[model samples]
Target: MRSDQPNYDVDPTILQPPGTPVWVADEAWRELARAAARLDRAVVVVDCYPGVDEQAVKASLERVFDVVVSVPDEAARPTEEIDALVAANLGDDRVFGYITQFNVADLYDEARLAELRRRVHERTGPIVLMGWGARLAAPDADVLVLADMPRWEHQLRMRAGMPNWRCKNGDEDILRKYKRSFFVEWRMADRHKQPLLDALDYLLDTTISADEARLITGDTFRSALDAAITRPFRFVPYFDPGVWGGHWMQEVLGLPGDVPNYAWGFDCVPEENSLALDIDGVRVEMPSQNLVLRKPIELMGPGTFARFGADFPIRFDFLDTFGGGNLSLQVHPLTGYIQEKFGMKYTQDESYYLLDVGDDGGVYLGRKPGADFDEMFDELEKAQRGEGSFPDERFINRFNARKHDHVLIPAGTVHCSTRNTMVLEISATSYIFTFKMWDWDRVGLDGKPRPVHLDHARANVQWDRDTDWVTSNLINRIDVLEQGDGYRIERTGLHELEYIETVRHWFSVPTLRDTQSTVHVLNLVEGRAAVVESPTGAFEPYEVHYAETFIVPAHVGEYTIRPADGAGECATLTAHVRGTEFPRSVSGEDLRFSGRSAS
Candidate 1:
């Protein structure tokens, strides 16, 4: 049975080395004071991610040091200058923004930074420098600390009237704020943070409220990130409601009913999700991207890591539309388009694997036979200008869907899932790049019109993919690969042009599997529950219930999966990059994972 509360935490008890101290609440502040006592004149730099409570960090540091300096406030460029600088990248669009290549130091005033440096050198006792770009003020420090927060947490704080790093636009539109973060601030912050994380002495979890916070030594924190990829693990999942949301997740996952409906279940978005690391007894939550950035080879394997360094290519998420409205008609950019336009290496080439289908569940896919492209574009432009409503049926074809149906949706393909269908979207990680052609005349839950990118859609939509071509190419393109006693395997595709390969496995008995030197994502599509464990008892057995997505890291080279006792006929849908392969060795003992094997 599906557990209301699923497991996404990674403990790595056996793998963890001793002497990792976890300081919480008041103890966290005290530990910094204790560390400062060791130095004659301590220069502790608390480098922060934007949107973290810089004031609270400064207040806490004052309890440890004689004085705390806000580096960004003292030396950073004015809010207006920062805004004007990024205006070109932010663009005039309500949804899209081109990625900027500027570094965080670009926003700092060099004269002010030099002046702040002179003042800091004049101090005698312990000093604390706190703000987004504190490290820029003092490259060499007695102790370095990172006050961290994730992108999603930043979004929550923004919606609650919190502004960006140095801006006073607290009452700005949430989408505009997000666009700036995604296109401007986040890219710059990440570029600034990568080197700091490697040389850090401490990491403070600033996402938590002021009453109770978590802190750990950088060694212990880095060790935990290394320990995570040695076995199977999952990132913490987050859910959100939309105008076209559904009731399945709210009921099945036992989510709060306060929201109108649950539109998305973010199971494996590394950039936006977090991971809770168990350090002895305390829970330390950190962004999953930290692991991706730190250990790209072990987590993604050499194959995918070579193609996309520090970028998590594969993504899995849930789209719940049951008893709600249809998703907006959308198309994603092709790889060349994404690379040239947005500075991304790839695009959102995705597939919808139907997990649950209600009576009226279906999808709008491909163009109708002999549909006039010019006429459709004209109608879309007219609808955007409020001249008339878009007639979707005039251009698109509707296909009835069923449970366990897998449909491939490569970039440039026109597609949209309808109401009453639960979709598990297995795709590339760049989901934010989707260009909406129409929104079905529906407004968002906030009573605002969702932004449509008809111009971008016009440049990318595949006009060649007609109804007949879709039937032959994208829908239910399954091939029987292998079968044995109490086991069967089939290749469920993501198309030839797409890089991701998918397969479905059904087994009542224990089935041995190999990771093929690459990361693999799986969801329990059928039966009640199943357990994934090391083949030679390397890692502890991990249980997954129905509809829960789990990841098998590339370092876990070999593993086994079987239905739990009392559960029957379990099945899983697996996804991975296409070219990652490891030929079976001819002889010798199996190379199972161990605590000693972890980095």
Candidate 2:
């Protein structure tokens, strides 16, 4: 029999609605029908997230309204113009692109927009305007219905021969389509959507299927968003396989066996993760970021929202190479380099916390002290040119990893998590700015060579951070700040350069924690299950399992973490913005984040 003792949760949800307010199937259509009774010549706009099936919407609208106008057909920019607009961000390569500064409204024709506006006004019947950014077509529509879907759903649609918004390239490469979405379409769409989502009249969910749509009133949606920030919750985690993917997640996480392996488990990357709502027992899914967008002050705190502006500044994900191959050696750009090169606000500064590792293998990190740089770059370029494999051992330092060992990697530091290790990667939320210098001479799962940005790596690598620096500062620099009645707190190294501060707690009994005005993301790294509860019952008691990540809202103020009833010793790793002081290793009340943070 296949093994089935895995405890990974695949469908974690947040925000349980109070009543059965959702309308489904024909009831959804009837709700729209009642809204457009042709009594007063009303206009309803179904503004959509890109990749939504316009035809499905048109059919649904045609069933309810006498006049249905597709906003995309009315004002979408010409195909040639769209290609020219996104060309810079859609660089010649496949897996990379700079973030686009354009907006979805910029993809409209002003002349056509005016004409459509006139036509809608001239109509004497209940009219429906629909498409991506459809409200841009009729700004003062009587009722606003926002059709939204998760990014993962959009990726699935892309694989199903759907084109990028306003383009006719359905048969194009999937990677290119994703690149378009990542660097261009999504950025533009999100910018257009945030304000609209803030005041939407209705929130529509069509991710389950086109034929069966779920509809909820905007009031209920807002209630759900409000409820989300009062407690700790988990986002739906999505898993994917890659060239260096391994079977650990598939076996340990109880994933479907259809994929070859599970390489990445996006546990806390909300931008791509789904947040499920338990709406009267019928689970509905939406992008987790909507919570971040609609309730930043409550969820992320005022200081954090003011600093990052609705973006979830911290990220937690898994990189499993156990029973597989090495991850590509890479470097992240410095803040100035990323800002100047990619139009981004910040750079990725990360740490790899080893969850599991074998004795013979470790992580490749930093470089040998005083290595010949000219020769290393030349060799990498030659490897990119197919001359030979980049000789990693000649220049890079390999540090042996162990269970619960944390490795801090600042921007421009060369590093990679090698085979036979399960890594929980905690970092700043700039998720996709890695500059790959080498890939161990292998193609991707698509059987094509992975893109290596040797030039970018050369421009940013910190030559001074050699073996000595990494050993002294990055590897396993844990400071035991305090031991208390039933717990001890340890400050894990994330280096001074990184904005995220990580702390570990080992507890056999309940441990008290205060939010300290910053959001805390924690993982049950060494326990079967742990319980998170409010001191005064401010929130429901939340249960978390091993390798599971949950968020404590910045305003939670005070909470407690302990092993689920009768469970044994447990450990957790918590990450928050660096705002508290780090105290020297000591006894008594000097615990990192004990009463304060473990600084």
Candidate 3:
């Protein structure tokens, strides 16, 4: 409803016209204005996370409406009973307005929902059904609004004792408790709401003040999505402290010095990372998966989208061990193993691109020459039971690591990044399937031994990948493909893996290229920064800094890259799905070593 005093601090361009019914999915802190001039009857139904301020919302609604009714005075009644009670109150002369709690658990009852909507449709005045599931329940709503906050911000609020519907005990582990109880529900709600975005009238960034809930219209939302896909975007990086965490991120990434140590930085992981959007000098964050969900074919090429659907098939992250300890010796399940056991479509075929390394930096990769698999298994079992110690040096081979060295790690390979090194991990989207085999007989940061997965490791380990074979086949195999004035292109990756391909471009002058309907994930490995611009001046130029990762959307077709104004020559690693072409340097002999026939 209209308000002469400016009911909301929203961008005027994105606000709905007067008399539009809006369904707002919002944070507890923000509420619809109580005293709008146009609303003769207004209702606010709130079934929110445990810690929201329900009383404030009720108070706000009462200030404007002629009458306000809170249905089902008993909060624990069944949905059918609650609906009957609400229906019974509709004829009350004073019940011109209704504020009812719409619970997530009630979404399963389609028949009950249809009946409830039919009853509401018979009413005569304006109605505002505002809550978590209100939009889903009322599909014919005039406007849909999503009120969101970044996960980290929500965690901070939860830690500060924000009213939560799930957590009542006020435990010290409230964040963990809240996530355990409601994360799945939140994810489901997010997925269900994404398809309705085209009908969204306004997206309120509730992280801001109520007066400034950044309003984004449906058209603006579409524009932002297009810009997000075509431009160099950054996901909000999340950091974690682990027992084996190191100081590199704290020093290099200049993270807050308060954390004990930084172990991993999720840079572009859509499953866990949130995209930060700067809109009109205000910041708004949403799950990164929303981009892929909104424009699959535009973000990922048509071919890739056809193959993977809405999945963003690649992941990039940082593993910081500089001035710390080694990672546990681990193996990832093979493609078939993961599909059968984990119900996943793909396996984790990863690589380690060393960003920085100390003098003793090295990677524990493959098995030692002449390693006895049966003996190793016996030793592993004994170590697990505290009956014997692991002979680390005698069973695994260690390869010295240098800055910018690329180490390929196909599924089933045993590997770990050693201490005093920072690794830029590039891999398939399937993560969290690691099988730790050894941990140097050391305990975790909690002073307890970490659980090991020896059986799983043994089941997937490739016994044929010994020191000699790994050194000859998995090590850096770079071959110059083409050279020009002040520029060169080289093929560099685990080409025999048959999943994804990587190439490097070293150039000082401007270069133009097309994506060819294939998405490319790139990192400027060896320059201060570079400017990526539309070849036809269609969009703004995107400036990417050194060590920064960005994506080239499949639909962009062609783009140009040049050294940032004052920077020198630049080297960028470009990664994409390997459709059909095979590297020319990988001989049939190398393919045999990898146990794969040449294509």
What TM-score fits each model?
0.94, 0.95, 0.77
Off by over 4 Å in 2: 1-4, 580-592, 595-599
Count backbone clashes in candidate 2: 7
Give a tens-digit lDDT track for model 1, residues 330-448: 99999999988887788999999998888789899999998999999999989888888999989999999999999999999999999998999999989589898888888887788
Measured on C-alpha atoms, candidate 3 has an lDDT of 0.64
573: Cα error in model 3, Å? 1.0
> Alpha-carbon error at 309 in model 1, in Å?
0.7
> How would you encode candidate 2's per-residue C-alpha lDDT over 134-180 as one tens digit per residue?
89878988888988889988898998899988778899888889989
In order of listing, the candidates' clash counts read 0, 7, 7
Summing lDDT over every window of 10 consecutive residues in candidate 1, give the lowest-scoring window: 590-599
Task: Name the lDDT value of residue 146 in candidate 2.
Answer: 89
- On the 0 to 100 scale, the lDDT of residue 427 in model 2 is 91
lDDT at 167 for candidate 1?
Answer: 81
**Candidate 1 or 3, higher TM-score?**
1
Candidate 3 local lDDT, 518-552, one digit each (tens): 78788777777788888578768777777677788
